[model samples]
Structure formats: C-alpha cells, structure tokens
Target chain A: MASKASTLETEMPTEPTKRLDTFANPNPDRDYQIHIRIPEFTCLCPKTGQPDFAEMQLVYVPDEACIELKSLKLYIWSYRNEGAFHEAVTNRILDDLVAATIPRYMEITARFNVRGGLYTTVVARHGRPPASLERSDA
Target chain B: MLDEAGRRRGILAQAWPAGQSLSPAAWLRHALQLIALIRRRRPSAEIAAIAVDGTSGTTFLCDTTSGRPLTPVMAYNDGRAGIEARALAARGLAEGPASGPYGGPAKLLWLTRHYGAPSGAGIAAQASWLSGALLGHYGLMDEHNALKLGFDGSWTQILRERPFTVRLPHVVPAGTPLGPLCRTLTRRLGLRSAPLVVAGTTDSTAAFLALGSLPVGCGVSSLGSTLVLKIESPHPISVPEFGIYSHRLPKTWLVGGASNSGAAVLAHYFDRPTLARLSATLPLPTSPRLDYYPLLAPGERFPVSDPRLAPRLSPRPADDRLFLQGLLEGLAAIEARGYALLARYGAPRLQRVVTTGGGATNGAWRAIREQALEVPISLAADRPAAFGAARLARAGWLDTR
Candidate 1:
C-alpha cells in the first residue's frame, strides 16, 4: 500500500478548496451517551524530530447531526506531522468539528501523554439544555 | 404512511431465545428472589397477555413460586464453560456438537458443578427470569431460547428427562399467555396496570426485526459502537470458531462476528462538520497499500480474527490526517469484505443495506461504503437499540400502524 501511495505522489490528493459546513436540521433534542478513545495519536513539527502528543477523546450526545466518521478520521489524520502546537491542534480539531456537525452538546479533550517529562491534557466542551438546544454553552 | 419518497420502513424488536444455556435451576434461583425488583417497581400494567423470554440459553436456580433466582445467569457471550461445552459435544449429549462461548449447556454445567446454583430462585431460565420479573411467576421457556442450550430443536420430546446435566425452561409458543402479573407485583411495582406483554424475543432477534424480516439467507450489518455482521442461514451455523450464535429463529441462526473496528475510531478524531467536508474528499479505493486493517487503536475481532492485531498504516504515514484517511479506507474495505463473505456463505447478496447508529448517519461513510461495496445503503429512521428494545417489549412493533 505504501509503494502505491508513493508512485501516485504526483497525483494531487483531494485536498479541500474551501471549508464550509451547512446543516439541514440546526437544532435537535435527544439524550446522548457518546464516548471516544484515541490510543494511538502522535504529532510533531516538521522541523522538530521530538514527539508532540495529545490524548484525544470526545464524548457527546447528539440532537440533529453527529460527526461523520470517515471525514472525522481524515480530519484528524490531516493534523498528523503538521507544524501545530498542542493547544492549537486541540481547539482546531474541536472548532472544525463544531462547524461541520451542529451537535446539541459537544466535549473535546486532548490528552497528550508525557513527553519531555511534561504531561498536557486539554479539555473543551459545549452543552445545551434539552429545551434550549439552539444556543451553545461554550 | 408514505413519505414524499414513497418508501416503507418501521421499527422492529426481539431478544435471544430459550434453550439458550442458562440452567433452569439457576434461573429459578433468581426468579424466586427477583420479587424484589418487581416489589420495588410496583408496576401496575393494565394487563394483556405477557411475554417472558431469556438471554439465549441461560437457566437459573430459583424458588418456584415467587420465581426468585437462586443462581447467577450466565450471558451468552461468557466463556467460562468452553471446556464443559466441548465435553458435552464429545459425549454426544448436545446437538451439533459445536462448542463455543455462546454454547448454553456447557456454561450451565459449569455453574451447576462449581457453585451448586443460587438459592430462592434455585435453578432457573432466562425466560423464567423475565416472566418472574414481569408476571411474578416462572413460565415455561420458549423454543428459540431453549434450543441454543443443547436441547433438541424439536419441541415435541419435551426435553425434561435429559439428565442431571442441566435444567431446562418450560418451552412455550409465542403469544402464549403464561398468566397475569402477580398481585404483589401489581401493588408493588405497579405492573398490574400494565398492558399485556407478549413472549419477548432476544436482542439480536429485535435487531433482525428492526432491520426487516429478511427471509432465509437474509441478514443485517449492525454498525454501531461495534461492527456486527449478522446473517441468516438455511442451516444453523453454530461454529464457535467465528463467534456464531444459534438464534431462536427456527431454521435460521445469527452468524458472523463483531470487530472492535467501528465508528468509535472515527469519533476519536473528527467532530462532525469537518468530517463531512473530508467525506467530500475521500480518495477512491485505489490505494495499493492494504497495510491498514484499520483499527484506530489496538485489537480487532472479525475479518482477521486476531485480538493482538495492531493497527498498521503501511509505508508509515506522513501526517496524522493521512494515517487517519488510510485507517478509514481500511475499515470500509473490511466492512465490504465481511458482508461479502456472509453473502458467499448464507446471506442474500447485498441488494439494499439499511444502516443505523450515530456513525451510520454520516453521508460520507455511507457514500464510501456504497462505492466500496458497490451497493446501496440507507440510514434508518431511528438508530437506537432502545427503539428495538421497546419493540421487543411490545412484541412486533411493526404489525401495528
């Protein structure tokens, strides 16, 4: 699979031209118990060979639209080996996600395992009451 | 009811059948004592016929009258009795002689031999547990639940005289009214005011109903937190080798297995909208690298069937995003292959795939699947196990409106 990808390196990949997300149903009301775990995640600046890290986990209940998996995977994979700091990466993933799927309540956590003897975990969340799902609790 | 598109769809439900392995003695143990939950709930259901079923081949030790459980019910997925199951098949005491974690009688024997069963409920059945819970009595076990536990599929022999090897549930037909809720339950749990309960079906059975009453060789691919590929067959495929289960569906069974690889992996990365845009940019299934079995993390069940199987992205990934894309594509391929194998064996060829769960709602994944499998897939109206569970509680949720 690696060789094939390399041979086709000249073939421009399907990178997005513009990042815009629209929803059919803007608000929804439902109880949700969403859980996620990322056991394998690594990031580092192209210039620095040192390993940058994030413990990425998200659990949310959905009302109208939830994050799509394939696209989500691609979006996450897009950050790998990029020149982004830990905090920026965490919020960026969350921001892009919120824009894509207008969920009722969202929680995004990035737990970067100990690197350089320093452990960093960032937690971000937004919630909405069942009755007032249109507003965000960011 | 017709939508603007003019299509037919409805909610479905069911659960595992009787003869599903829990010894009747064990079920009775809990059944006799289960009076507590009822007493606590004080269910006052108005009344109709009640349905009592089991968790696929589970029997308990119970006290007869109150249907209180004496034994701990063994789930179909529990594997403590693999040795006993194999021994039973070896002795010709079981049907088909296939030994598995889901195999019923073996687990029962293990419980019977090790613990001597629960008190009060004594030895019991899954249906008995449910019956005791709902009606305050242990009714007979239904057939599908009965069969999975090594009972002869033929309901005529009555299966009572088999041996001290295991206890059996009182097998009954669907819609058969066992009786009414106990007065104590009526007063305590408020079940007395409840409408009639039908002979409830199993979880997977309800899933089958939820999907469609897909005939012989038909099945459902439940892509939830776990990717479960269930296919119906002409012959019961009870091979423990692949995590297959003998379903209560008379001549049919629910075969195939679950893989840790599922939408859970996707959830680890994207939120939703960004996921949609990425969906718009999915590469065609032309990647030469099959290096990705695509488990976002560690371990997988179906397809390769290796628990130690680690997630591998070939040629190593240049970026997290690239690695993630490779993973998603791998999952899509695995899904297609799993369903295709089922089709090759027993299930009908992929004509229309009905998808459910939070992940299934994603158009991007759906499109990728359609292209990967070369078939049509649609999102269901409700993507919830609760919906199906309610239907099972209500018998066939579809036959009404």
Candidate 2:
C-alpha cells in the first residue's frame, strides 16, 4: 500500500519563476486572437511601498510563438513584492510579453483599484493589428 | 473555556479558510463557527466570559461610529511600510516596539496616506476589533496590542507627538473586563446569557500566559510560521535595531524577538505529510552539514534585522533527505542565535526552553534544537493560543465576581 505522503512527494507544484515562457503557436499560418485575463494582479506602490492591486487584460495575436499559461502566472506572481508605478509596470508587462512571443499585435490594460480617491488605468500596446482584422471588425 | 477547577469542558480548533484575507467578515465567520461548535458539544455548560488574542502588530482602519472596517488588514509580517517606519525613526521615534516596518504605527501611516483618513476613521487591532464586535462597540484595545502602536503607558503623549489623524483605541491591561457581550450575539448564538468580554493580549503573549508559570530565567520558543523567542526577565528590554522588544506582564517582562526563518520555509518546499516522512528518515547524530540560512524571501527580522538579507540555501545536495536535514539544522541554528542575541541585549540567560507550536511535536527537530541550544527542551502542556485567551477570560470573569 502506498502512503499519502509518498504519493504527494511526486505531485508538488513547481516553484514560482520570473522568466516568461512560450511555446510554438499551434496555427502560425492563420491569424487569430488570444485574450487572457488575470484577475489577481498585485504589486507594490513605488512611492509609499503599499500594495497596489489591478485586473490585467492581455489581448494579442500570436505570430511564431504563444505564451504558456503556468509560466505567465508565475511571472505575474514574481512581482507580488516588487515596487513599480502602474504606468511602468503595465508597459513592462507588454514589453516582456512581446519580447517572449514576438506577437504581431499585443495590448495590455491594467485597471488599478481606487487609492486616495483616485483610480488609475494604464494601457500599453506593441506592434499594429492587421488590416484584415480591422476590416472584419468593421 | 476552563471551569473553576481548571479542567477543560470543551475545546475546538479551526484553520483559517483558504484564499480568505483576515477581514472582519472572515473573523466573524470563524468566531461564530467556533462558538457554535463549542455550544453544540457542551450545551449545558454556562459560558462566563470571552477574550480574543491576535497577532501583535496586525491592524487596520475602521469607522468609529459604525464599527465598520474601512481598509484591508495590514498583517503582522507586512513590510510595505518600510518608508513610513524610516520616517518615524528619523523623527526620533526609534527606541520603541513600533520602530520597524512591521509595527502598527508604520502600517497606520501607510493606511492613512493611501486610504485618506475620513472624519470618523479609527485604528483597530485584531483582538480589539473582535472583542468590540462581540460588545457592539469598537474603541477598546489591550496594552499588549497597543505596544506596537507606540503606546508606552502614555497614549496622550503619543497622540500629541505623532502626526496621526485617525482616532487611536483606548488601551487597557490584559484580563480587564470591557463589557458583557451584546444581547444580539447571545440570542443569535443561543446562549443563556451574555458573557463578559475581556481585553486580551497579543497571540504570543497569550501563549506565554498558557504556560502555567515560569521562573525568571526560563524562555519559550514558538516555532509557528515564524520563530518567536521570549524569555522572562525582571526588567523590560528594548533593542529596536535587532527587532527586540518586551511585553509587560503582571509579574515579569517578556523580552524577545521573532526571526523570519521557521517552519514556513519548510512548508514552501514540502507539504506537512512529506515533511513528517522525510524528517523520520534523517540521521540524528549530526546535521547534514549544509550551512543554510533558510528564508522564504530576501528579508530577516531578528538575530539579524537587515531587511535586505538574502537567504543562503545554495550548495545543493542531491538527496532530498539530506536537504531536509540541512533546513532543519539551519532553523535550529537560528533558534540558538536568537536566544544568544536576546541574552546579549539584557534579557535573562535562558535556563530552559519550553517549545510550542506545530514544530514542537517533531522529536527529531526537538533533539537537534536541544543540541544547538544547549538547554533542555520541553513541549508545552497546552499549545493553542486560544487556551491562553480562555485563561484571560477566566481571570477577568473571576475578578469581576
């Protein structure tokens, strides 16, 4: 009979990581969109060192590679204790994603919660959408 | 709660729910659950009083008029107020319990700056807020919890000197009766009568009280998520640089410091069952000889109070059992150094160490700790912090009669 402890040793989750990971896109020949929503994004305020929370929406059209889900989650978690402004952090996420996947079109929108009677939202974009996608939307 | 003859009638323990922040709603839910469980188990038993103990520096803002939470809880280990702590220190408020980023004063400043203090805003500790919730009022705070809020037997002076805009709680001694539980709770919980709500100490202090009695030279090591070391001393000691401070008791002062290294570091790498299994197979004569300072993150609080201290878990060995031994040995070494540091800072020399918390049950770890500490290690008779809170409740109820 196998003990529960012995069984659990082999099923442990991987440690959190800071590096973004990607895999080869399944349909690189065709142009399609991917939307990822991270509801539990949290970072620290650069000035006061207090925690700042946001809901991140990432929309991109993959070219040669696509971002891996678990790796993206870990990458986001790596910033839990880091201190950065909303604008800088939002732009940095888009930049990192673009660098990892080299997507044809990538956009990141961060909706930060209200702090001191002010709500902050930052949007960053990389590359341009294809004319075909614009025409389809129209 | 314990009866007059000091025999336990009923007891219950509940873990904090997963993915739940330490908010007022979560606290009330747990409190009600525990009360209901105890009542169901011992229906005929008459409850006399209730006291609540929480982490020493855990605090949040609340509305004074409505007793409503206005901000999220700043946990005891939250180090986001480093800037505010430094600012306070620069203003010559350095030599007290509230001198670090984890202190209540810094958290309050951070909350005020970020949340914007309203007209009826006030600060509340976990124990105070819970007790107030029971009493339908919210201004009272125990002295032990207030210690980290810069309360040194003088709230008026502290308020006059500091630049806080929120209303500070009225601090009282532990075991002091605040009031009877509100009638609504009695009816809702189906209790025969409202129990007196007693002021409670911090969780660690409450644990200290659970120890039946200890001599001046005796020490207690709490191996919970963090390594907390407290020794009974004739005089209070304060060393803010090393994160050492003293909590006042009726007869003696408990001088101690907490380390960032403890069982939580092990929990990061292995589950509880895995830890127990691996610990059973480790060689007991000597440690794996890996000089590792295990930390979950980059900061340390005691024995070395550098906020930027990096963990030294490198020079990896392939064997998981060896690695577990190394981590256990590292924690034991930290415990030794913590006691040594406390002694260096005017605390009483440790004659014996009474161990408490989850790690106390590990015989292998205990043997290693005894070897490192050079003192006899004994497991506490009662390990739960609630038992101590119940003791406080019993004492307060007796005094009133």
Candidate 3:
C-alpha cells in the first residue's frame, strides 16, 4: 500500500508536458475528420502578459499517424503561461498538429471570447482537399 | 360580456413548432406555415405590415427570377469561409468586426468560389432574402444585415473592389417599406388586406425594438450566456476597436457591445437549480470586499479590452451561497463598468436599465445591479422578437404615410 501510494504521488507531474507524440493511424487509406473541441483553452497575451481564454476546435484528417490524446492535452496545457496573440497561437497549433500527424487535411478554429466588444475567431488550415471535394479547376 | 378594462388587445399566446434545418427552403416553408396559422386564428385582425428578423450573417445564393435558393443557407456560425476571410484580410479588403470567417461577406465569397454564381443570381443574408421573397423582390436588403456583408451605410464602391463578382442586394434602412405584399402571398394566406412588407433588421435589433419604448438615455442589457449592452445614442458611435458598433434607428443610434462574462461562468460553477436556490438565500456584499471577475476562462473584451485578462475568482469561501453572491456582485460591477465605458466613449448617459434574458428574473441579482449601477433597474415589459417585428411594421407603415 505504501509503495502504491508513493508511485501515485510521484507519477503526477507538476509541470506541463509539451511533447506531442503520435501513433499509426488504423485506417490510413481513408480520409476522416478528427474533431477536437477544447473549451477551456488558456494562454498568456503577448501584448499585456495577461491570460487569454478561448474556445478552440481542431479538425484534421490523418495520413500516417494520429495524435495521442494524453500528449495532445499536455501540449495544449503547455500554452498556459506562454505569451502569444490569437492569430499566432492558432497558426502555431496548426503547425504543431501538422508536424505531429502529417495530416492529409487540417483546420484549427480558435474563437477568443469577446474582448472590448469584438469576438476574434482565427481559422488556419493546411494540406490538400479530399479527392471528392476538390475544385475542378484546382 | 367582460368589462372594457379586462379585455386584452393582443391575441392569446400559442406555441408554434420551431423547425430549423440547413436548407433555406425548409425555413421558408416553416415561416409560411406560421403566418398562415396566425392569420387563420385571428381573422378579424387586419394585417397592416409584415417584417421578419433573421439570424445575422447567415448568407445564401439564390436566383432572382425563380425566387429559388441556389445554395443551402450558410449559417451565421459556419466557419467554412475562414480561408477566404484570411485571403480578403491579406488584401486589406476585409478587416473589422465584420471580416471574420463566420461573417456574411466571407461566407458569400466562399459560396461564389465553391458554387460559381450564374448571371442574374444574387447573394443575400437570411433576413434580406426572406423579406425580399415576401415583397416579390429579390435585391432588397437592410443595412443591419448588410453590415456583415461589409456594406457601410451607403458605400457601394467598397463592395465593387472585392475579387469575386456576385450581384449584391440593394441595402436600405431596417424599417424602410419595401412594397405591398405580393399578390401570390396574399392569396396563399387568404388575407382580407394586403399588408405592406417592410425591410427588416437582424434578430438582435428586432429584440431591442420589442422593448416598446426606450428613451434616448435608457439602455437594455441582455444577461444571457454572454452579457450584451445596448444604449440609444443621439449620435452614431462607431468604435470597432472595442467591438462596439451602432445600428441606425430613425432618430437615434443603438450603440452596443458584448462581453464574455455572464451566466455561462455561473453555470460552469453551479447548475441552474442550485444557482436559483443559492441566489434566493444569497447574502449581499457588505463592503465590496470579495471582488471577482467571473469568467469561465481568462480574457474579457467590454468595459476593459485586455485580451489576456485573467479570471479573478480566487479566495473562494467554503459556503456555496457566499461564493455565488461574490460572483453575482462581480458581474454587477462589470455591468456598471460597461455602461461607464460607453459613457466615456460618448454614448448617452444611462438613465434607466431595462434588463432581459434568463438572468433578469433573479431578484437578488437585480438588487446587486441596482446598488452597483446606482440606477433604476426594471425587467423588460416584453422581449419577444415577434413583438419587435410588429413594432417595426407599425413604424414602417407610419413612416410611409
């Protein structure tokens, strides 16, 4: 019992784990949307060094790998104290997701709750459109 | 017979089924059914003028000749136009509160790219399209709906600079008379009198009008999931930096701003039932000691425009009631600060506050707001969008005469 209790206490890390690791996608050949909604997203504002809150949604179609949930949560939590603007943070998240999964398609939508009176929603996407939805001219 | 004093002028409230689908035709069909049902119940009630309030920023592409929608209505919340918004912003064409992906202009641009607009097809927001259909016109749109389409009051040259080409609707003020109701619509509804179909505003604006009579100095505060503040200003105030904008009313401008803090933060901590129970017994703040910025997360816009502002919900007491009281007081303080900010920005002084939304019914919250605002606070006499639409119709008819 003493050993179990000690293991539990030590297992919980005090600092955020920024490492975003991935695993092989079970269905690599097919294109499917992976929708992730993070309602309690928080990061420091670069301008004021104040904490910015946003509700964000990350959608992507995986190619070879899929982002591990535990690591992704840790990676998002890492932004808590980091200073970044709405547009920069949104693009950075997309870049990180792409690097981790090498997704066929991805879109990150971050709606920073109203500040002053304006609600800012930043959407950044990468990769090619699926074969079915691609424009004819493109 | 009942006494003259006992008789109510309005029709008895009847619940109608609300059916909202992705398709524009579905909404139109539902609307037609609602109108027919209302007319059938009250045959003696002469229909004077009709107005519709639609979801702001919802856009659609349609053929003018056939009055048929060419594409599914892109909802106000749709984010499919994010790429287009960024591209437009890059070109400096789309900037401001109306430049986001969910905005009408971005959605219209997205529609044109995805489904090429044929010649004679027009792009319109939901309210514009509905009113146009009723009035037997295809190009009529109100300025309120046109705002998200980047139409600044009377600016057509600005829209001409966009990369894509689609016939933009003719923008008019919200209460302007479009024309008499179409012969086909009148016959379909079996109305004795053909009511004039007027240009309509967005749902929120219609809600403001529904409050009946708001003097220049009075304001209405919507305490929903978010806190929205709107005051009638003598001169139009256009401060987009703080997410504040003015909607044109006949003699006054409706200057308003929205905040991230409200009942949503309260709901995050305690359920509605628990909040109600606690609020009933909640103690008042004696000396304004436990100050909090009750936000579900960090960051707030209105009153203070700090993008990184942190939620100040610390040093919470053990008793749930006390904690709830502190949160209520904090929200009231924010409300007071928002009005003060508006005043600083040259909006008319807030003489009285008319409260609406789910949070408005709380007596405890009202007391807190009264003390914080140092102004008379009263619940809105009526808040239905329908009542506001009726008021618009009456005003439009009066204006035409």
lDDT of 2 by residue, A3-48 (tens): 8888787776765555555667776546678889999999999999
Model 1 CAPRI rating: incorrect
Which regions of candidate 1 fall more than 4 Å away from where they truly are? A1-138, B1-60, B73-98, B118-128, B143-148, B151-164, B173-176, B187-194, B211-219, B231-288, B294-316, B386-401
> Which runs in model 3 stand beyond 4 Å of their true positions?
A1-138, B1-21, B93-95, B155-158, B286-291, B297-301, B304-317
Looking at model 1, residue A58 earns an lDDT score of 73
Give model 3's TM-score versus the native structure.
0.67
**What would the per-residue lDDT of candidate 3 be over residues B89-206, giving only the tens digit for each residue?**
6766444447668766678778988888888878778888878778777888888888777777764343566555677778888889989888988898888878888788888888
Error of 3 at B279 (Å): 0.7
Q: Which candidate is the best by lDDT?
A: 2
> Alpha carbon lDDT of residue B334, candidate 3?
91
* Tens-digit lDDT string for candidate 1 (A2-85): 988887886756542112233333333335445666655667745576767666887665543555565556556655656777
- Cα displacement (Å) at residue B283, model 3: 3.5
TM-score of each: 0.53, 0.67, 0.67
Docking quality tier of model 3: incorrect
Candidate 3 chain B minimal-lDDT segment of 10 residues: B1-10
Ranking the candidates on lDDT from highest down gives 2, 3, 1
